[model samples]
Target: MDLTVLSYVIYLFISIVLTVWVARTLSRAGRVFLAQVFPGSEHLAEAVNHLLVVGFYLVNLGFVSLYLKSGATTETARQVFEGLSVKEGVVLLVLGGMHLGNVFVLNKLRSNSRRDFAVIPPIPPTGFLPEVEA
Candidate 1:
């Protein structure tokens, strides 16, 4: 097999495996945070989590497939490793960025939800009403 073809295969395999692992990890752990963000709606949280995983797969896999092409010829072993490293590195960075974006948005939602449900003290009624004349 051509080294370039080998590199493409390796890159696709690693990218897909990493994406699925990260998505599953996030879905499992994020449920609690989502539940808190959408208090009294565990079902909604679960639904949102499932949707998120599906979207994640669609997006990351699309990116992986689109990014599969190597810019330079890969005739040598060193070139194959270099290509794989660069490709995988970019994939990792993209994954990290997506994770951070998700967390940032969810944290904002959680904060807003907390603020909406915050308790405020009521003010005491002010001084005396006028007496009525007989």
Candidate 2:
């Protein structure tokens, strides 16, 4: 196999693996945050975590599979170094960036959930008032 093909394959593999790993980690940590977000329903929070991971994988993998590889060619050290084309690089960068962004957004959501549900003061119960005789 050619080096370029190998490189592309490695890149794709690593990108997918990284994305999935991050997604799973976020989902696991998200349970706590999700609890905060939804407050009263642990089941709902767990479901949301699962759904987020599923959606994240579906979107990211679809994009990665559809990504176009750069043209293959031979070149000297300088050419090879300078040969990093804008299109391919941009696509890979975007892929990585999207994964990173997903993690960031999910983390923020989790934190917000936690903050939104921290704690509350207890409510006081009122006894019945005495009725006046007519």
Candidate 3:
């Protein structure tokens, strides 16, 4: 097999395995955070978590497929390793970015939810004011 082909195979395998592992880890751990953000809606949190995982897979896999092609042809073992490293690095970076983006958006949602549930002082009714003769 050509070095380039081997690199591509290894890259795809590693990238896919990493993606699945990360996705599962996030989904499992993020449920608590999602539940907190949703507040009294564990079902909704789970649903959202599932949807997020699906979307994550779609986007990341699409990126992986699109990025499969290497600019330079690999002939040597060193070149194969180098190519794999670069490709894997990009995949890792993309995964990290996606994870961060998800966390940022979820944090915003949690913050907003907290704000929505914040306590507010009640105002006195206008009609409760005593009338004074002029």
User: Which candidate achieves the best lDDT against the true structure?
Assistant: 3
Error of 2 at 124 (Å): 17
lDDT of each: 0.89, 0.67, 0.90
**What is candidate 2's lDDT per residue for 89-130, written digit by digit as tens?**
655576567667766776788787677667787888688778
Worst 10 residues of 2 by lDDT: 78-87
lDDT of 3 by residue, 1-134 (tens): 88888898999999999999989988987887788888888889999999999999999999999999989988899999988888899999999999998888778888888888897989867776678999
| All candidates: TM-score | 0.88, 0.58, 0.88
Q: Where does candidate 2 clash, by residue pair?
A: none
| Candidate 3 lDDT for residue 64 | 99
Q: What would the TM-score be for candidate 1 when compared with the true structure?
A: 0.88
Residue 133, model 2: lDDT of: 100
Q: Count the backbone clashes (under 3 Å) in each candidate.
A: 0, 0, 0
